[model samples]
Target chain A: MQNPAAPAWTADHFFAGARACIPVAISVAAYGVVWGVLAKQAGLSLLEVMLMSGLVFAGSAQFVALDLWTATPSTLPIGPIILATLIVNLRYLLLTATMRPLVRPGTEKRSAAAMWLLSDENWAMTVGEMAKGRGSIAFLVGGGTTVWCFWMVATVFGRLIGSAIDDPTKYGLDFAFTATFLALLLGMWKGKADLLPWLVAALVAIISAKLIPGSWYILTGGIAGSFAGAIAERRRGYAHQS
Target chain B: MLTSPEALLAIAGMLAVTVAIKASGLLLANRLPQTGFIAAWLRHIPGAVLASLVAPAVVTGGTAEILAAAATALVFVVARNLFAAMATGVIMVFLLRMALGG
Candidate 1:
């Protein structure tokens, strides 16, 4: 069912999304800075770095690509890098799919434009808004715009300030993502019914993270937990009928 | 460092794939069912995916990280504010690091 209170596409909705996403944008900015410094160290030019962040726009994938990059084009390991990036980004397939309901009843152009702005941070924020019964494309766009602007600016800034700061991690900026994510997760917690699926997700994620490489844990744990949640939901339905 | 045509080409390729993945669900929206089991399952994805993201990092992190994460969760549960929770975690990590010499 559609949310009756869902706002229409307006400048206000866009700004609301932007305002809501500012906190998460802080973490995104930190990560973007890190990516910029790393990309610089990986021998990317300023133009290239901006282009990558602007075009690719995937943090983990860009990092993975940097890890595989080399000055010699032939030795760049393009195939492996591309593969790893694809794997790391496989979750977007599911993420975008889940967004369909929220973004529906819009034009092909609007839908396509919204899809381009989709990122993990924006998606999480949008979904959280939806869970709160405030689903709106304007919110998504606003949040996505905020994140995009911060990401681009942070990357360029990081590149310019590269090598000046010795360790960003030492400042505990690495925890920014984890902290932001935890907050989002807590925000999304529905009730006791969510405990099992979340626990399953944690268990599977920890295992997959240890056993596998790259970001496979995210996809595996996500899928496994989805199944567990679905099963729990079915059982609850059965109980109600009985 | 300067931009190379080859690198630009590679970046373009990566961009294409990334965009394709991001748009895949929308592109297939018509063909996919939006009800029943699939819908139910999709509903749980955000929580599961987010939990997975945090769990691995916390598990693999040091004592400071664990403690900070705990603090973050506590603040989130109490305040129900994302900014407050994240700020608590970040600040806690810094404090713990300084105090514990990590």
Candidate 2:
């Protein structure tokens, strides 16, 4: 019952506008599989993985938590655990803000609710498409739903194959995050002025890691960068693309 | 290691903090002009936010992570293709494992 000839404005638009997301989805699913495999291999119970995936509904944080727990099984990483998850998922705030204008005003609450259901792939698709001024609610449903179901399935599947994912050196999975990030950064860096604040933040984040824990660097660095970027935008009287 | 009670507490706490952080932007987005201080900040948000996410993942990594990241950066810079860079990165890691007998 699929409409094959629809314009690129709907969720189907992503199929036409960008084929890259397909690989992105595969990377995410593979990571999910890695998470699934690691959960059991780390000696944690399956209930832990299922519950974490179901409730936490986060990918990077879950992987980080599993790694921490595996490395040190003596103590629970609940505090740092929660903080890490929060920090990694904090980008969603930005994603939702981008959608505010396009969202139906009457459905603000519903749209906000739907934001929680978002993930990296769909978020990228939504914001990227919207930036081009080709926004639609259908895009959200099509792309968001696709990401959501794929994630749940990927997590469940990842756990099943958790044992086989032990070779960290082999999967090249870490770079998947890196490349996606770089691509995103380049996509955003449309001008010369965007360079300075980012360099400052990178320097600060690395320096902060030396002073604080692994995760605090990200939190502090992000706040510092956002504040720095905001202030710079104010002073320069520069018009932002947002 | 947390029981159901502990897990509930952890999740609830996470939800509370996340909601609090997001609320400020949500509220400000409603109040501010479509193109003003808030909007400008928002405009810069995507690039800045993405930079923050990728920086740590790339440079602050271990041996395997770094090696793979290098390949990713190389591909992204040259190819300028998102999928190709990511795939090359993932493939590099898998190949590294195979070559190293890991």
Candidate 3:
């Protein structure tokens, strides 16, 4: 069946996107503040922290980078840090690819801009909206913009208040990351068929996290689970055919 | 902490690579075959990846975290609301930690 004409990209859509993301944005802001505080404690200047957040815009990568950051400039492990960041952000490739169809064909500039703003939260929001048959470039831009702004503000706020807090984990903020990701994972669960792949992914991830160093577990688990899911799907297809 | 120049360079490099990765998907989307095993496999990747990301964290976290994750998952299953699930998890963790005197 032909898809209905997509809604026009307009300010209203953009604002709607922003409005839709407000709740998620609150969580994103919380995470952002954590990143900011951590970045400050990691010996980053306010300028560097802002720059990293503004330019990179990936909370996971930024957190990993800060963890790898060192006070002594000469001792900073740029190679490992960059490699880890790359590994964490590699998931964006798959995410952006999934977004291809939803993203209306437009100027190269617009496409690039949209892609640049494609973080997991906004991507999830956009995909969810599209699934509901209500999505547009404007909505994406608006949502991304809202997240970007909130992230920056939260980061700055965290930096300013970081020294006073001492231990962020004591407040159970450390659980926020896992909680957020778990929430996202729940949203992505399809049905009973997803059970096998998700189980495989969890097992693989735990093993990899324990055995392997760095962030290789993410890639390993993702690939293993995808393969498991594909094989299951293929088998189901055969069963249906027979 | 890297030197000012080194820090700037690292940030710029990270920006470049991230943008490149993000854009590569769109650029290559047209070239990718739209059907068959590859498509089916790609479709499952997001869930797998997210599960992978969440698993280690949930497994490694202490009892409070485990309990919180369970509560969060339960709320998510029941409500299907992201914010509510996350809030449930965070609050659970806080309360659990407080009750346990952790």
Candidate 4:
């Protein structure tokens, strides 16, 4: 069946996207604050906090950066920090790769600007709308702008007040990262087809995380699991053909 | 306050690579085959990456962590709300750790 007329790339759709993302923006702000607090504890100066959050603009990567941060700049492991960020943010390649349908043809530059602001939350929201046959690039930009604003503000606020919270572990705040990521993984559940990939990824990650002393497990597991998924699908396809 | 060269370089490197990754996806989307093995693999990357991210932490975090992960998944599945599920997991881990004499 032909898709209905695509939504117009107008200000109205933009604002509608922003309004729809209010709840998600709230959650993003919450995580942003957590990251900010952790950044402060990790010996990041206020200026550093602003630059990292403003430029990097990725939650997981920022968090991992903190884990690799050193108190003294002279001894900082710059190479490892950058490498970890690359690995953590590599998932965006997949997230943003599926954006062809959202942007209009011949507008790659503008779409690149929009993609820069794309967070997991807004991307999911925009894609969800696409699945319903009622989304546009404006909607995505609107939602992404909202999330970006909240993240910048909340993270700065957390850094300013970081001194107040000396011990995050006392309140079990450390577990927040695991919990958030767990929920995200659960939210991605499609069906039985996902079982093989997820299992392989998890098992490989568990073993690699122990053997190697870095964030390489994420890269390795992601590659291994995705290949496993593709191979499984190929086999199923062959079975059907036969 | 002035930022160090190391910090600036690190952030710049991160910014460069991240932008490249995000932009490459959109720029290459047109060239990528929509239906094929590559597409199927791309479809699975998000879940696999997430699983890889969360698994080690959950597996090695001890009893409190393991239980909290379960609560996290259950709350997420039921409420379909990310914030609520995360809160439930945090609270469960907190209480469990205390009760078990953390």
Candidate 5:
């Protein structure tokens, strides 16, 4: 199917979405920048830094892969490391699905074009906007495109200047991504409605990480929380009936 | 080592598999009404999923770190202000890290 005609990008939509995306992009960019710099410091060539940032386009997964690659007594197979990184980034699958209702079905060309631009912040903001039902798609297109451009630029820039700086750790910029994610999570959480699941998942992750290594945090916590949540909701339904 | 042919092939195969699983499941979900237990379970995905990711980082980092991050989450939860909570936690942690000489 041909692309659906939407409203032209107005100044208002441009400003609105651009404003939303700027801070998100900055946090993400900073994280990517630090990753690039650290990856360089850790022995990635400028070529590797650029290639990974552009092609893989995953920040957290790259970090995990980097950590495992750099670990002292390397216990993991290279294939397993790659696959674990694959699982960590699998949330993108759900992200793409969330975007589907916003875009046309079977428009794989357009979807594929947009896939590289998708990330947690962008997807959440876009989905939240789309859920509101009256915002311009122009906001999404403008903001998402702007973010995609900057993420690459920041990574390359950080790699260039980062080596000159003696201690990137001194600035405490490393924790900013963690801060940003916490902020994002709070905003996304609706109410007391989700508090139980949130607590349960966190507890489960803490236990699982202690038990397993090599990024089992991604799998064990996810499975445990999901299963617990399922059970909890079923009991709630039973209570409502009683 | 990252550029080895073996590494590249591994990455490629993994990506292909991840994409296919997502695409197929999503296609089926669209055709389906998302009713029954699966849909109920799916609703837990976003929170449960993210907490699963974030908690390990905070938790294993130490209870002090976890509590500090929770202080951040608490403010956001209470005030419902995203930037304020994020900024305060980061600033507090930075200062604490500085003081502790970590």
Candidate 6:
């Protein structure tokens, strides 16, 4: 199903991707700074911050990690932490699956190499362009690089200045975490189709968080909610077909 | 600066799994079916995960948090800006906490 004349990766597309990400980059920097502040409070050292933002490089998972982090080494929940990262990032399977068209058969290795840079923001932008018949691997990488730079710099900067702010709640910084996630959830809205799954997820999470000790609520809620969505969508499809 | 060995190990683990998940999608795309229950389930995962992350906190928090969340949603809808909504929530929580004497 490959377009025979699909244009090759080029400088123009790369820069265009970067330029297109400029506005999204602002938001990336915003939450990045917040993540840094929270990470510092969560007791991550500067070197750890650099390593995480540089290597792990996923925003939502990184934020979830902070919630799971503990300052004391003896009490650190390494297993749950790793499990949470995997569960939270599992959605990438779907995101990157949509990019298969851009990967010609032989270029799988090269394209997979670039998956490290893939992010929800850039992926959405690249897909938007793809709809218009104007996307390439270069464009996706360009946007990812831009978001990466912003995330790194902003996070480090937040960690630096975060030292000065002793009491986060006094300045409502604790609320910032909830606020950011709430904003993100709102941003994911795709009309009434999302209503059921979100409600189910919210209800399950709230109940599980009360009963369970660790972050298992997140995993349960995500799986349960997504299954609910699939079931609902299937019912809607059968109704339409019939 | 590096902290404990455990921390390093955990971060390394996180890096490994994250890379694996991202790579598997592109590599396995051809083999996976384009549509079906699995596809719909996968499509809903990100939003559901995010909702899971946010909902518990909001439900468990004090009055200020619930009110601030509403404000955040309102500001986000009006401005369509993440940062602005966050700022609004922060400022609202700060003021509400003071006014409500909590």
How good is the docking of model 5, by CAPRI class? Answer: acceptable
Output the number of the lDDT-best candidate.
6
> Could you give candidate 6's per-residue lDDT for residues A131-205 as a string of tens digits?
998898889999999999999999999888889988878888888888888888888899899999999999999
lDDT of 5 at A198: 75
Clashes of each: 0, 8, 1, 0, 0, 0
lDDT for each candidate structure? 0.78, 0.60, 0.78, 0.84, 0.62, 0.89
Positional deviation of residue A74's Cα in model 5 after best superposition, in angstroms: 7.7
Against the correct fold, how does model 2 do in TM-score? 0.69
Write down the C-alpha DockQ for each prediction. 0.47, 0.34, 0.51, 0.62, 0.39, 0.76
Mark the regions of model 6 whose C-alpha exceeds 4 Å error after superposition. A1-4
lDDT of 6 by residue, B1-102 (tens): 568988998899999999999998988987877778888998899889888998998889889989999999999999988899999999999999999989
Write down the DockQ of candidate 1. 0.47
Error of 2 at A235 (Å): 3.3
Off by over 4 Å in 5: A1-24, A41-43, A63-67, A71-86, A101-109, A128-142, A164-181, B6-29, B60-67, B74-90
Could you tell me the lDDT of residue A100 within candidate 6?
A: 77
Docking class of 4: medium
Query: What would the per-residue lDDT of candidate 1 be over residues B1-102, giving only the tens digit for each residue?
Result: 477767877888788888877787666766665556776687787688778878999999889999999999999999887667877897899889988898
- Show where candidate 3 strays beyond 4 Å: A1-24, A38-44, A60-106, A120-136, B1-10
Model 3 CAPRI rating: medium
Of 4 and 6, the candidate ranking higher by TM-score: 6
Could you tell me which residue pairs clash in candidate 2?
Answer: A33-A158, A36-A158, A36-A159, A37-A162, A170-B93, A170-B94, A172-B93, A242-B43
lDDT of 1 by residue, A1-242 (tens): 23234456789888898999998898788768867876766677889888988888887677657756776665566665666566556667777776666654435456656777888888889899878877577788898889989999999998888667556567776576788778878988889989988999999999999999766687788789888998898888888889
**lDDT of candidate 2 at residue A52, scale 0 to 100:** 68
Q: Candidate 2 docking category?
A: acceptable
